[model samples]
Target: MAGGTDAGAGAAAEVPGLVGVPLLGSLFDLKSDSLGTYLRAQHRHGDLVRVTAGPPGMRAELYCVFSPEGAQQVLASEAANFRKDNAFYQEVRDSFGNGLLTSQDEDYLRQRRLVQPLFTRRRVDGYAGAVAAETASVIAAWDKAPDGVVDVSDEMTHLALRAVARILFGTDVEATAEAVARCFPVITDYVLRRGYSPANIPRHWPTPGNRRAAAAMDELYGVCDKIIAERRGAGAHTAGRGTAAQDGPVQDDPAQDSAVPGGAGEDLLTLLAAARSSDDGEFDASELRDQVLIFLLAGHETTATSLCFALHLLARHPEEQDRAREEISRVLGDRTPEAADMDRLPYLTRVLKEAMRLYPAAPVIGRKAVADTRIGEHTVPAGADVILAPWVTHRHPAHWPDPDRFDPERFTPEAEAARPRYAWFPFGGGPRACIGQHFSMLESVVALAMILRAYEFEAVDTEIPVGAGITLRTDGPVRCRARRVDG
Candidate 1:
């Protein structure tokens, strides 16, 4: 492929120089509505477009290619040249340390090898029961209210947090749910705002929202630390000692309880404790702490946002909602769905897929090129930021017919097989793809099935505006009425 060559076949006309002003070039337009701006850029410029930002004229490139050939090249063929951008990684590192989400290259490879097994299909399936039980408990609590309006975002956040707490921490932690909820806006706000502003402020400084976020993070970590302490205290004495250490007296530190025998605990913390690296190295306390924070934020918030949007979509499109309900009813009959039933609920899965396509939780995945690379006919300079947007790709007319329309059939095996591999990347693609993809899919299937089996959703406010930050969400509360369904 010739760099800078106009491959006129599927290319839009290239604009000379970068789009937007220096220091803030296209930043406002990009941030205002990411998907819309991306589409416009692709239509106006070409598959590859240049954007400038920062005071010293830092330039980045955006690609909105829906072609199978282009998608494959970026996501797979030239993956080595592309890596997560420093700005995004720095934000996560500030919050999560150098855990899996923020770690690069060799560190990422090592962490992934150790953590990948935990998300295997079998292990992910094990979490279905916990997802179902948590969904049921949440619905049961909601049943106490009589035909009232509920904020779907708030409700979903609470449900996801509770589910993660029960399954990942082995502690209900219901009392702290309110406190945890308060932390998200602050965290999200700081992250999004900092992306545009160049100033770097320490978390310890008494800034308004930053201080609250720091406190909330402390509260969140405090809960995890307490759980770790409890487990360590219980498991310390019985923890296995190697044959060479038989002569030594055992220390009474509760922290050693993480080394307990038999892998007895159900919490993710315990699993992390018991998990050994492929090379047999164990995660130390700090590593374990960083992972806990990463999982807590990544596991719940995105799933919660997706579920909220799914419900909102169902509310607006009654026919699709009916199909989902019918599928749930027929698949499970009268019993609650188990892991085995997930494979049988194809329509439910399709509905969730379409929901994610229409309203992706994480709108875009970004990368920075480490070396000069040619994508199609364009030679992207080293240090240029590259973005793969699910929000834009899922709505691209070239891949999806009536791209803006909400249709579940697009996810049917035949329909899905017809599109490019990266055409509908809600959770991303390739080696660095989301490790929790299966887990999130299973969680959504089980939760949506359980909800549909009991109630029919109706839209109370059809005009609710969509918003974005870490996840695509409703601007205001998603008010909806849930009517009981006859069994």
Candidate 2:
């Protein structure tokens, strides 16, 4: 009854759609090549496409908005009409806990109010030293790589994990990074498998998959909980500072100073542990764990994907790589990059932006229409699923003339200004836009600059096929060989 309702008497025709085969609908197609499916749907139909899946008796209808304008409407203008009341979000919330990423309404607002201060430009920039240190470690290891070829995907993933971990856990980075690196993939995979299924056994059941996922969840939670408890009990200011003080007295050098303010060796974990709202409400232990878990999961995986693809693309295109390298050389001839250098290297920043465009970390975003809404000519009735697909919209031919081609110039000032606001959002737009977007860009630009300055890359595995997991995942290794750059 709800599905049949219209926006009004003059509502436009039904949304163009892909009518899948009987029974299973587009399940197999989605499970196989979701990105391709979204792309084809846009090419065949129009922006607003209706997709139906599942059996006749249990059919699920999805209203897909793939145009920049439509995306703006769904994610920004009329964002309240579309809610994260979908199944996938529920799965993420269940496993990851309702941190800023999945929380809604007042809870999200409160979390945002408290967490926003931690991500200010000044504070995030302070983490540049941490990012550079991690990149240096990766470069040092690559210096000894057999034949100079390294798995770019795996290496970036580890590098990003360590970088974020250092900023999050400080001296405890080694232990936390190890546990997270081991446990996050298992949990994310479990979330994906169960999230998409029409039916699932209770997670507490003793099935192999259940047991494995539960074990991973326990291990991941154990590490975070342990650190959080120690921080709370010992006091956030002094808890994680043990190793820093033991290693040596505080250095006067800016490069060697702790990433946090006051040079007290404070990490983001301690900041979160001690953050207080206007009313002096702090995150409880469970709330602290939830925030840390989401930060670990979102912080590392998205940035790693960006760095991997950026390096791979530059490898595939030598001229672009040289240009970027030249900029880095000109800016910082023989010194480590800092927060101030983020804006100094614009071309390198463009390369990173282009890479994100081609392989957005979160390709397909899910939402549900809570009321009858008109998108263009079609009316999406109440209680229908809605999908805002950056994967498809990024390649929309109307704006991006040659969408698939790798061109950093597309992000140049004039070019970017000419396009619609939502046309190039790797981070979703609106009140709910990614809180870590600035942080992601800073980490990416800083790391990419340092790595390119250190080595020249030539892609060995160029044709990387990616799939939509919880985030974009490469189907196989993305390999590249690096030769050290001479001054």
Candidate 3:
């Protein structure tokens, strides 16, 4: 087994001079929102500190080994030793089934490979027009009521949901959007509650929240099933028929049989229907349905949360926001940005990066050690839960100077090069890093550019409450006043 430091060779090096109560060690302080208390303990106790929670064997620990060397050791050098912990995965599994985020080992790898291509730059870029169109529509709607206070969070949620729906299902997303939206609050609320209490109860004897969550999940899945059925039928209709390669019906093309290699690119449903296993195995309809549901559920909400935070930050920091808007105007005068234009929007990119750094959509990523391993100088037990928190690490003063300040300059190419590789992990790290990262980034940039070009946003309130569950978000509604930019 590996170890961080050898204070005295054979013993689990007790943190130097740090004291804790018999039970309920640091839980009270932690729950009371004392980040400094925990951070101070880390500073005083060295790299690793262990403290008992509410009960014996209910221990909580903190590890400050988040440097590039430590991140490489945990994420790459000894990755096999880590797996999703039961406590964390249980909550995600209960809500999302064994989707990419919750699945582990072989299953996770397989699903990831299959889904990876969908998030490639080419594929993601393909949706640029859809993103721009949807964002424009939302902005237009907002323009209708300039004087009224707008709940920007709600606006972002709807906009992101619509954009993702178009990308995944193609055309007329109204019904599906309604179904998914109906279930979102329930899923979000349940996930948040489970974080505080990591126990399981029978679904049949559900609490009111659980019952609603379960029902919402069922309803959402029902919508996915219907979409899959429709696509499957379409696939069947096109399977045997010889269709034209381009600009004509399948039956009309000269080389119809060989024209379109594999699946059609018309929509996500078509892609999934045509997607075949590398081993020539066919995807069952249910698997396709589950995957579609996973994409919609996971993709939209996370992006929405991040965008909401980004808007709030921009409104608060007007100079940064102005810089971003100026860059957008310079790059794209009156034209909507195409995929190629993303490369030119440096300030907008920085704004998005800084926003995500402050409030990562998925704040913490955790894994359970499968075998004894040394992370830095600490000897992690085989079953110990290891957590790498972007929320915490992204703001670590050692890694980032004046980390709390909303500074987009930190993301400049020169500034970025100066930092450690793993110092800013807004989308996580290693082989399990988000496949849709580029896609999400592209979408965010485009959406922000469109909004900025159309409106000048001002903070309606100075004080905004923040909270975190699956994603960091404003506790109450975030209202902003948007004045249309002068022509």
Candidate 4:
């Protein structure tokens, strides 16, 4: 089916929305409860629904698509008609600049080509041992702690940060880890908060929140710059991994061998430093820093957030946890999980898919209509905002039966293949989907295997407190009782 709907001459009709109170529109509603308000609008309206936000002068209409067909239309079919220059990307670029996530057109293509090799399947798999090591390093701290409540959210956050820090920047970034951990949340939260708000204040204005965000950004970028400076300045020095090492294993890319500079290093900063264009040009300081910042911030935070939810879901559903643990026990036993073992652990993979389906780390994918476009039969005006919510779409009863239940079997090969492509896009779809998705999933699977194998998690609360931001995050923290496992 073409986008799962047949569009006709009615393309000029206006998309539906509430004629809200005078100037406010849905500003208060979205600001107060974005996730709730968004889902409700989709249910009450239809798959392709319209929601308004902001005051009269700055009134904005957003098209929220919950149908896979609609998602395919914007993300795949007519993707070129949409651009990433939406409010969300604009604000986020404050931290990411023109990195892959924010860059478009030729810039995006070039940078994507340069950075794509780092996340190739073979490379990511090679990094698995490192993922396990980093995760082991953080969770090991908890092994000796007294039995009590730990914010597993905080735990995963630290684990994911340290894992990405070393994996991407190598051991040298270990010193910058604490500072980056402290600062990035501020910067990212600020960017996300602004992205969701209907009314946006100017960054040039000295707002307290903006000032705090700016300061956090400085600290965040300072760390990135330090890593870049150190990597480039050292000539051939890397923490421990030599220049000859590939970031992972060389998969299929011929560019990998030559893309890297003189076999000096393969950590992200080193690779970027070594990366040369067809023109034999190296990135300037700003260009290099931008890519690092995106990887460092987006790389860790999104996975950490997903990991936090996955652990929480398993904690609440002991049966699912037990099933997954059984699989881990069978495949991994008392041994640690390596990337090579991933394909052997099918059930563990399903558990992750189900968890992400319920609580997608990136709940909404935002785009702007660059030209008038037809989403289904409706004409979306140029400059209008388009939002695809994996949060809502993943729960749509049309595609998913028992939408709220914790069921991993839905992700089994037979079941997943039965659904449409965009029906369960946790990392998004089409060309602009998350570049680090493979890397993120591998990190999560490795961490999950290790955590399940070593510990038993008891939920302190049945209700999950969720907040929407640069990524979906638990409002305060996801607390659980942790007890180390014994053979």
Candidate 5:
């Protein structure tokens, strides 16, 4: 929140940058194609390029960090010096509530501590059953597809939403899933538009956009709140006798004993309802809604993106697809896949990893420099808005040769060990990394293994244009023809 000291200010060399039109700079270019802008900036201006836009008083200077080394410095090594104090993040926090993804400083620390246990490897693996069930449902539904053609994008999105909803709400999943499907697009689109805009009309104003976003939020919040209330009521019936609240937190085994009345026992909602810390008590109803909302937003969309792209890539490359399918068949024959199958099916994991390498969910990560920090040879002054782009860093020529190629071999254990830790950070790195990392991977590997096992895909749409939103998004349907593997 403070600026760089006067002592360091004069000596700090200016970062090499892209100078666009006078006053406006590169704002329009960035707005039009941020991913392209990031790539061009890295290729033409090197990793640490300054990209400024807007007129004098409203100008925004983006200190872009594109190299693996620089990404590490900003996101991991010198992470404390780079805080999530940017406008985009603030907008997210306001829209979604200060849950783990948007919370900072002590609040982030507290949220992480409270939410960590729920996402542990042991706990996340438990959700694989849910993922398998959801994936099976999707695979079965493909039987109705006309001529066995399906949109990988739409299908994966639906599958992921169902999977996460089932895990999060359990028996109440049906109640929450449709609402999330209907409202999330409205909310995320609103966040993106307002987040990038230089200025925005006050949300309270009766503008059409504001009214629409408000209605969507109300519907979304209303549904989630009703479920939370019902879950609490059910918990009270089971544990509190006639009282509305539980006696206290489930201290002995919060993860296991947190089940409520309807057999939604180990679902994330129950866990959050029962989550407690020595210093901090359990989440209140409002807090619970916030955490659930954030999880739904982050959980489904990211894995769906990874699954869509992975299937599309495999559809486009049959030989690679065959190799991955062979591995799946060898490892899991005539049976549903589970989380434990992840290590046994290493090649499939590599396929998913390679897909993430190409199409990372969160492409452009933002931060504000908390102090004068040296990145590579450039000094990013305190208070400067910084961008850590995984989309660019994952494809950095120094780290990834033939970066544009879709080769799962790139993620082989040996190849991965040889590369910089930050070179292929699709889940990001450091303390503030995604809390649901294991859940995401577990869901993806299990779902992908099953889907690949069910169908042999041939890409109908060989190419998909993408744009950056809250996550990487496709501009058009990623279509593929699915023939039954048995046939």
Candidate 6:
């Protein structure tokens, strides 16, 4: 961060870029094919490329750092120079308010401190049976599917939502989960279009897009309110009992709190609902609502898509699918998976990592430059948006040999050790990385193992159509059938 601008200042101006038709620059190209555009530019322009786009006369800049060196510069080494901005931040904040993902500085730090305890190994290990039980129940419902043709995307979505609802909030808001399922795609689509496009449309404009987004938010907020009210009704002191006031940290054997509506265990919402600050002010209702809403979406949607993509990839590659199923069977031997079994199922972890490489849960990591910084030979100006794309970086031929091929061995300890850390960040790097990474990984491993153990899925169609929204997801239903293989 200390390097003078004189070093790479001129190089920044000379950095190679994509030629555009007009003020829209690469905006149109992004609309047609975003992944293709980024990869193509990374190939032609090397690691540092400046992307600019806007309406006819306006030009907005979005700098892309593709190489691991550049990624390190922004994410780890010089992270202080780059901070979350109002660009994408404003839009995300509008949705979840001041939750963990969108907050910065002291406010973010405080919220992070409060939420981090809820995801520590001690807390997360207690949610495995909840995840496994939900997985079993889902498979049972699949047993009722007439021909066993199931939508893996929808199925995974419900599984993740139920898990988050039951484990995180300690309640099952089924109707809200259903509402998010119905309304989220539209909301994600709207967010992406407005976030990237040169069009500066105000939310209060009441355009068709605005109206649809508003309606969806109403449905989502209605659910959030209900969840908050219920948790608050349980008495804050009761919810806060076992959470924040831990007697230091302690390890334990595998166990899950049967934290359902009628269960005796404490939930995240209940914990926060009961929490009070040093000054004796109780946790604000809005903060609880904001954080819970974030956990619901993040804990549910991203993990669901990751599982869906992993299943899709496994089905496409029979060798990998069989290998994964075999590992699950050998490890559990007809018994359901417990959190402890995760260590024994290395292949499943590799498959999940490989799938994440091909289809990262969060595709693009965006940050704003708080100060001028030198990324390799290019000196990026302050106020610019720095974009680190896992989708592009993971597949870049330089870092990954035969990057397009689906091979889980790429995640072997030896292989991972040989590469740069930023080369494989499904969860964003640095201090602001995802708080739910552990919970997500555990849930995916358990759920993927459970699904493959009881049933094998076959691709209805070999072709995959990908989409980019709040999360990178399959464009349509991932149609596959569940064939029972267990006695």
Top candidate, metric lDDT: 2
Candidate 4 local lDDT, residue 379 = 67
lDDT, candidate 3, equals 0.70
lDDT of 5 by residue, 1-487 (tens): 1222234655655688897898899988988899999899999989889999887888899999988888888888788899988888887887888888888888887667677766656657768788888899889989889999999999999999998898888888887899999998888899999989888888999999888989999999999899889878887224421112233342334434333322335577876777775576678899989899999999999999999999999999999999999999999988888778889999999999999999999998999988888765668888999998999999999989999999999988899999988998888889888888888888899988988888999999987999899999899899999998884
What do the candidate models score in CA lDDT, each in turn?
Answer: 0.69, 0.85, 0.70, 0.78, 0.84, 0.77
Better of 2 and 4 by lDDT: 2
lDDT of 1 by residue, 220-284 (tens): 66766766677667763233422111112223333333232222465556666656633536666
Clashing pairs in 4: 243-263, 243-264, 243-265
Q: For residues 1-487, could you state the per-residue lDDT of candidate 4 as single tens digits?
A: 3332223425455678855566777888777777887788878877777888777677788888778888888888788878888878988887677898889998887776667655666656666777788788777787666666778888888888888777667666577678787887788778877877667788878989989988888877787787778777887333223223234333555444333221226666776666554532556778988887788778888898888888888999889889989989999877878777778889888988998999998887889887776666566677878888888999988889989998999999999889999899888778888888988888999999998888888998678768578778677768888788778
Q: Model 6: clashing residue pairs?
A: 236-274
| Candidate 6 Cα outliers beyond 4 Å, as residue runs | 1-8, 11-13, 245-265, 276-282
Residues 194-284 of candidate 3: C-alpha lDDT, one tens digit per residue: 7555355766687887678889889987888887788777663254322211221112223323323222445666665655454434447
Among all windows of ten consecutive residues in candidate 4, which has the lowest summed lDDT? Answer: 236-245
Q: Give each model a TM-score.
A: 0.86, 0.93, 0.87, 0.91, 0.93, 0.92
Ranking of all predicted structures according to lDDT, beginning with the best and ending with the worst = 2, 5, 4, 6, 3, 1
lDDT of 6 by residue, 77-171 (tens): 78888887846667777865678888888888667666655566756766787898889888888888878888888899889988887775555
Report model 2's TM-score to 2 decimal places. Answer: 0.93
**Ten-residue segment with the worst summed lDDT in candidate 6?**
253-262
